[model samples]
Target: MTSPASTSSKKSSPLESSHRRVPTACTRCRKRRTKCSGTNPCRNCIQNASECIFQVEDIRKVTVLESFITSLKRRITELEEKVGKKQKGENGTQMPSQANPTEIKDGVRAPDTKQDAKCDDTRGLAKRDSTKFDIHLEASTSEAVYSAIFAIFSQSPSDPPSPVRSCSTDESLYNDVLLLVPSPGLAQLFASVTFHRFSDYVNNVFQFLNCGYLSLEPLALINQVASFCEFEGKWRYFAPDAFMAKCCMIVALGELYEPAYCVSPRNVRLEPPLVDKVPPGFAYFKQAVALLPAFIIEEDELGTQSVLVVEALTLAAIYLRVINKNIASSNFSLQALQMTINMNLHVAPLETSQEDRRLFWAAYSLNRTISLRVGQPLLLSAEEIATPMPSVNQAPSQKQELYKSEIHPCYIQLAIISEDICKTIYRRKCTTQANGVSSLPRFTLSMLNILSKLVRWADALPQNLKLDACLTSQGSYESHTELDRNRRFIYSLHANYCHCIFITTVPLLINLVQEQKQKGSKGSLDNPNVWKIIHMNFEACSISLRLYESLYRGKLITTYGFMDHDYLFSIGLGFIMGQLFDFSAYPVDISKYEFLKSLGKVFNILTNLLHNGNRIAHYKCMQLLDLIRLNPDIERESTKMAPVMVPAAVPVAIPPPVTVPIPHPNDFFLPFDDLLFAEPTVGMINDFYSTMSVDYYNLTEDDFVLFSDTFDMHV
Candidate 1:
């Protein structure tokens, strides 16, 4: 049975032979289904192929188009090489050590594996080196190759890692080997991959890419594939915006193949399997293409928005693949992503109603902008997408408007994903890391730091310099406010990235717990139940972290969630919580988790505070119960929970025992007073509420009842 990826590739049927695409149409299609006449097929079948029994539409024109694009690229590379050669000859002076471009790029091994001999001529490209380049940092498209790589570099704060030492590779080589080399980078990236280094074969092919010492036919075809599939991105006819989208897709895929991690830092790798996990001490390619538009001087406003579409499509493609069940599914998704890459959506090339068009652009822009990273471009109906952007600055004109609905939800979603990815990796690294003895995977502190910074790029969105205000038509700007939680998030992320590089545990766990508690304050973070959200985020974070750790450090001990809560227990949450309360007075989840296997440390901490005796801290813990009760908003509304920027001196005493009425037993009390706060056991603590004796206006104990007895519990 064909694997999904292979099936998708095979399912790509031959296109009907238009006079133009004859060279590519299969002989069977050319001969009208009954089968081909001979060699290439004849005019009868060629013309009648449409009339043939085979389905006219079964063919996936998109893949064929992709093939066309790849062809063109190969052609271009040839031209570039020829041009370079001529330039070299024109100089007439022999230079001793001019490096081949492919040779200069290290980590890329020379392909030595045996590929089908016919694959070379049929594909118009050979698989010499077999190593792939991760064109991350732009919209990445994984087309016309063995596999693609996506690389993301971020700066983290949780685990500040040490500085990275760059691993340089050879530059001046290009060969047909690229065709067969397939996902060479994955060797450095610890993950399940089909591509193993072809080694000896990678050597000579790269020279072919440097100068047109080879044929141009393959290159021409490659370019067409890129254009139609919106993969390679050339011909410049698909509109600049479409091209940009394609570029973005390329970068996204590059990042994907960047590399994966071990489940832990200490687990032994699967012997030979380790060989493909990455070259020794490999360094990430520093230059990026996504920043290209920003690099352009004097970029126009509309163009900037257009470019974002590309970013959306590109980022979407890469992220989607990470979670996708089938790698080949990306090819289909790629076409959908490519559609919006065109600027025609904005320009309204077709004849349509003004209102309709306006509304369409509005919604499209919104969905695309948010999706720019995730790649699942909103399948908004053209009508909704066309919704006029909220009056480009609150204009009086008859422009339709959309509410400010997209950002908050989108941000939340993104934050959630980023957080989860972070935790997944963290747990992974801890468990898989070698005892400073095992061979490490390729991805190291440097890459994790880069990933942190990339995620923080979200925070950079609101920075004063340039906001992607596609939605803000016309709003007067107020003086920028001081740092918000978003800013704090980015800062914290920076610290986490750094910590990861250095591989320190205590600080990492401490920060996540502390920071999340801060987020859980009044309502904002707590509204959504910040603790739960943190759990989910860390889950994802741990997965991604583990994936990378294995590649850079060692394999994980287990594939499930990366780290056991025992790590949490062993590190001693009580010690961390104590420090957090001391320094910030915030509340974290001291609550027991069902998923957590062991409950040793938490009980110990609770007992320690009780035994060792810190009254003030104990009072605060009791106070936290009261605080939780006072602000039922703790769970109802997330906004209220943002860490208090500054301590506001409110009346600390619980309203001097004031109370009015208690309709339901769930009714809240006037003020909180310490109740029977015995050892925290399985039963719910009644001390959550306070008792206060106020004047006549305030009620008595008979008037008040416990809210918990009747009120529903917060999830």
Candidate 2:
């Protein structure tokens, strides 16, 4: 109060004080276009008896110059640090102490103002890190655009709610659903059959094919089955539906492998023929499917029981596939995948149990297999997968250790590469170019990469698991049980490997065929890339055909399933197409005899399957036979070729030939009968052969028609 000038300078102006006090406006006041008291509950809001809300201002307008300056400052600091480090290294001395030490603020180290000022000296020489700068700019631009759009469309309290109804149901409905569990006597019999015949095979061999079995503990599953068999009255338990479903699915799968269910003329005669009787496992599978809905509805409350539901669905899918119900199998596999994802199994945390990891990979492997087989899009991509491969060291037994250490990891890796193949080569965008010509160079590169991985996968196999080792040492096992397990495992592994090679190289074969057709000659194999493709396809077809022969002689072929049949058919078709188009134009001299013999063996296998009640096999066999008939010279050449040598170690026990009564020509075999036996018109055959060069997977049904019509027309 000594002087008026001093007092004026010390006190703030009225406008400045008012600006500080009114930092933001209340929503109620802003909506009315009136002045805000700035407090949370403003005077107007209090007077009107309405709640007041103040939204935080998150969007800050950044000028180009301001952003540039900030980037320049950051660049300068980075440059100074780099220079300091380099100078210290050159001088063989430590860096000088910073006058202003760094301090930690909000868990980030912040340099003092003095240290920042020192960085400004070399600002002109400092270069911007374009990679980081671009990323920052992109992030900022996206955020600003998003903020503006969000502000424009922000919801208000007065807005009405969405009209869509909830899907939630009463909890009582889930509990009230009837479960058709098997009686104790039947359950005991089925469980015994499963445990004795199927369970051991699954634990030792089949689990490698589809890893979902790894999630199940054999002893625990046994205990659960026993408990269920004894329990009475509605089967009350935690997640009872899922538990019963799992139990039923296990028994259903077991039924497929039982001796009575094995597809032979004897078995078919003892039971109803394929056309009349439902598949062996249908009763239990029906029960499993019925219980699945209740478990799915109450998935949230099930907790760890959710894994059992996935396992049940997976087993159901496998059983369905075994019976050749592919569409339904695909649906079940996809549902399991969806459930796995919902449970966060795909991105399993580090602390997740081994069982969970195994379950995740099983779902992943099965989905990938189905997608590749059906030409469907993948439900999950590799980028989204975080679960690690099942660990070998974690295996409780030496047998499990062998599989986990040697087979499981390799299989998972192959599945991943398979996914890559689907994405790179089969995806619609990658398959075609703007001008409509196939992208040959791009596809060729992808094929090479995938083949290299497949080669590595083969190379990484343990000594015992290798194809050559398993084949040569067939008599080396101590017992028939071990021999059976090893035979199935090695055969499956080798088959998958050959199939991958075929898939990788087949596109090139198609291209070569198309080019030869267009040019009207076996166009030059002078190109190394073309020759490489031919060699690969030749090797794959030869190995797979030979494997089929081995399986046939050993009586190890799955006569009922579509898998072996499909594999044999595809490889046979490849062989025929190669012979017809002269795929081995350059290398025909070396493999011609072997190739002819393999082709001849296919006929024998197909004939055997036909007698075993496999209609698909019958259809495939007839098609190949027709192709041979059309080309008599090829058959003459095959007849002259030496028969393939059957390994003496594997006893070729030819079962007593049972006469299979022929069904009426008009009789159908469920879904495939109509598709397989449909008469092909001239127009259909022309259209098929024209587009055959464009797609491979889509050609099976049409190819059947083409072959049948060609045979009929010729006869």
Candidate 3:
């Protein structure tokens, strides 16, 4: 058969040719100019829920060939001229072409010299064009292949730079800090006193140190110790473990001298206050971190994976965060988390000792919280976490009643709930939002399930643990310190509880706002679903505001940090949204003016926070304050509004698992009814954001930009 094929080669039909277009990318990926996995409904198309049609990509070989030919034409002419010149030279005639002209007269051009120069120039141009064309072709082909290969790969957003770690590690920069920091003896005394003051939370510190559990080898650095011991008195008897001593002193200094803990520290001024003054805990915190690597080295020699190592790291991370050294804090947290994993703490047996279990849970909680706080993906997933729930009965030996009182268990419970929120809602929300995709978890059924879980968790709490019961239980005869501390504890518990409620209900409120705006009754009070969800959000905001108001009035809360900031900011945002509820527009009985006044309280607290070292909260507070001021009528109405009866705390209820009707995600838009909120346009949001300090959290506006488009605004 091969011998018989000695005839002329046959031409293949275009349709039957081997060089056919075979699309390896979906249409969605092609439209996005991104790589596709080449699978049916490739990853990108799947995530965006877009069509995945694959069409043949026409290769423009003819165009490239034509350009390639055009580049060669000038060079072909140069070659012909050279051939003629060589033939003339072969005839032995004194060819003018062979004589090298030193310089040409202005009017007289040297033909051979000029032609050779032209030939070189043309050849270079042709080579460059050819190389560039090749590069373009290769780039196109390689990009497609690589895009397909790495279709699902995306870079993780980096964690915020921790201020603590960002500080110069050069020992000399801290020379002054070392001096201002308390002498080890006096530091011990101060720590002892502060620990006594915060004795209730001392176990948290102890658990963090693993002090009682881990046996540290006899410390050999007695001279290192002696230089630090400025006060040589009987107080020397008060020295705890060297590392514990540092941690305790660091936290004590943070509580006693940091403006975050109290207003008094702010009054003790430093020049330029913003940059000249270091935060209160900086000195001790820096020293502690400087000592960490050595401590870890020694601890690791004892055993590479000790709980003390994890605890020391945890303490460092927490104190780093406290001193506004977030980068350092996050670094330490990462180390601690890795250490926890190395020790298999997450999968430790349920029957492990309370100490082990407590350490593990603390690590789990700390890592998860930091991850969320810094906008990082969780290092520990729930599925990977094989540890059991911390029970009140399994309380650690120290302060049994305090442990048994359910403080920790309740906190842990909320943490677990919060973890789910972080994983399912916040994680997805943030990722999708970052990618400019507005997809949200299907809310109706998912939210109901989450709310039910929260309800069950809260309902299981002891009567005294309830927010309503606890607030009512405080008596007038109680001392200010006692009352303040008690209330703060209650406030913290309730704030976290409300935070869960707030996060869970806020999405529903978003849905309602979209529904109302679409119905052309943006502020109409007729829709029960709108009213019900709004009521829930208001309650969450109200509870948080009440706590801050009490704290502000008493001047008791010194540290209004992340927890406080989150609650305050969310509540303020809710109030701005609340302004959209026009009570006068309908015969609705909701206290719209009183609600604004309550929001006014949140604004007032935020205004105070501006001076308290939180830049983000201050900016948000100013925005809300401006929003209120711009709406003169709302401001006036709020001022004249009488105190409404505090709506009875909405009783926590779990609806018998029933699915509710929900609209599609695309139906929602950020509600910016200028008339409803008394702003000229949505540009006000962007304006407020522009004036805010540029921090990691404040820098991204996408979170707020969720409602960018206008839906139906006439019902």
Candidate 4:
């Protein structure tokens, strides 16, 4: 039995244990004022799914002091060894045997042991001194060979450090280093004048674009702009080049879409030549481009500044697309996508803020659109993306209106389906059969499945954004301003929906054309699925034409807009293919009168585009019209109508038709062949068709490559 006093002395006092504090707390627990276990990855941090960071100043100071003491000890040992060696040499006698090689042991000198030697060897291996051979190469001959090889590549000690460092340090001294950025006063003026117009454009014209592609909230952006204009010193808080670039982009987009800058169909013929007249926002856009190098190249870390850079790039891409610079727009979008991936924004764990997720999705959407348009593979695929779609409900009340929450998630779903179509249908594959047929059955099934999803997606849209609601209630919105905005939103959505339908069915149309060419029309038309596909494709083309006509009447479609022209061109080609192949032989729902009217509408739209300084549109219109006039069946139909289809509201006189000389098979003037391929073979034709099988909204000049065998088919 132990005594009571001895037992009390052995146990710690309760008061003493309660008063004791941990050495340090994790950042999360410190913020929350909660108890911490003082361990790496504290229990509270683990429970909260947060990172455990210990940034205690005392611990860092103590570590620095210990390093200082160890360094001092090393220096003292080296001096002592020198002194002992000098004494032994002067006295001509060996030092005492008890004096062993010294090593650092807890801030004191001790005898060097085998363990310390092993640690020293490990440190030496890690250092990997380039002047000497590697430790593993212990053989004398290997050392000699290594020394010989290293001598060839190594710089001489007499030589100064690289001149590259001089260039980097004095980069600002170069005359060209000074970009033509706007003065602060001029920049503020530009921002103030254009920002409201840009806001109005976003709210009215392109409402469907309210997805968080802008990254920052409108209020936040407005505040930043205000601060930038009022406080010249705000650059200290933000990256000057990146922030200014973003401001310039916002102003550029605003100027691009300003109502005063908007050209209606009636005014298109009155405008000057495209090359002679500067673009609406060219000045500001040029400034942004000049500043972009600083923004993109200087930043090495991922943060809010990097996110702003992505937004600027995205805005630049949109501006480029609007001005018909499709290739440049795609390149910008790809860069933004690559930046997002580099920042780990595509992964969920690194998505530290809602802005990051929004920026990631925006990059993804833009990249997917451009890649699909250009017939390029996606840099980041749907399967590889770990970030979640933006949620409207998760957004704050003030920002709820800024996000088209319901529409964006649905848009993401549609984008995924579009990706599936690209991967499954348009992906290049080798033909195994002797007939050069590759998985027609698999292709047909894939088309049907994708078409079903598209149909369901459109049907599931909110009532306000539904295609039927917008189409049926078109003229009813004349009284209500809110209803008109909804109408515009619905129009954009319907156009995308029609584009998806058209893209999904095009490959089937090509397959049907091929089958008919080989087995005759009757055998191909025997399948009921072929009839369904033909009717769906026809409806898609017709609906798209009508949508464009409505947008044209509203003055919402810009002549300089590449997407509008691309849509018209693609639909025109689809109609031409239908007429050339005589698809009316099948029991399709569309009548001959409706088909001719839609085709006539497309022809008129393209003709109007020709007068608007759209050089590509002129080429496209001529190619399409020539295809019609050259075909015997369509020529008869076209000749029976007026020389040119003109809308009644537009009083502009039609220009005289400039006859384009027909090119010989071997001539360099073959537009279609020159635009894409050198030779016109069936394989080249198939490749062109495959390119057209995806989205056409971002078609560049090179994408105008059509069937080069037009003469052969007509003959």
How many clashes does each candidate structure show, in the order listed?
A: 210, 0, 17, 0
Q: Between which residue pairs do clashes occur in model 2?
A: none
Ranking by TM-score: 4, 2, 3, 1
* Candidates' C-alpha lDDT: 0.27, 0.52, 0.45, 0.52
User: How much is the lDDT of residue 686 in candidate 4?
Assistant: 37
Candidate 3, 167-274: lDDT as tens digits: 221112233544555445434434444323333234323322212112221122233334444353112323334444344443544443332344321232221113
Decide which is better by TM-score, 1 or 3: 3
Q: Which residue pairs show backbone clashes in model 4?
A: none
Model 4 misplaced regions, further than 4 Å: 1-216, 230-240, 261-273, 349-352, 394-403, 431-438, 471-483, 514-524, 643-715
How should the candidates be ordered by lDDT, best one leading? 4, 2, 3, 1
What local lDDT score does residue 121 receive in model 3, on the 0 to 100 scale? 41
Q: How many backbone collisions does model 1 have?
A: 210
404 in model 2: Cα distance from truth in Å? 4.4
Model 2, span 460-496: residue lDDT tens:
7677776656656664322112235455566666677
**Model 4 C-alpha lDDT per residue in residues 1-715, reported as the tens digit of each score:** 9998558645857664443348688787888897677778886678778899988675443436645875786677667667777888899765542254333332112223443333234332233211111111111111111122222222331122222211121222222322333335334435445444445543432432434234546556765555544333222223346776776676666655554433333444533235334555566677777677776786664356787788889888877766555557778999998899988888877446666777888788777765665544578888998888776544536533434455566667777877887776556232223443222234455566677677666656666455544555553332112234444445555666667777667644543443444343454244444455566677677666656655555556555563566677668767866765655566654463255555666655565555555544554554454445444556566545544432112111323223332221111111111112111233432332332343422323332122111100100
Candidate 1 positional error at 689, Å: 21
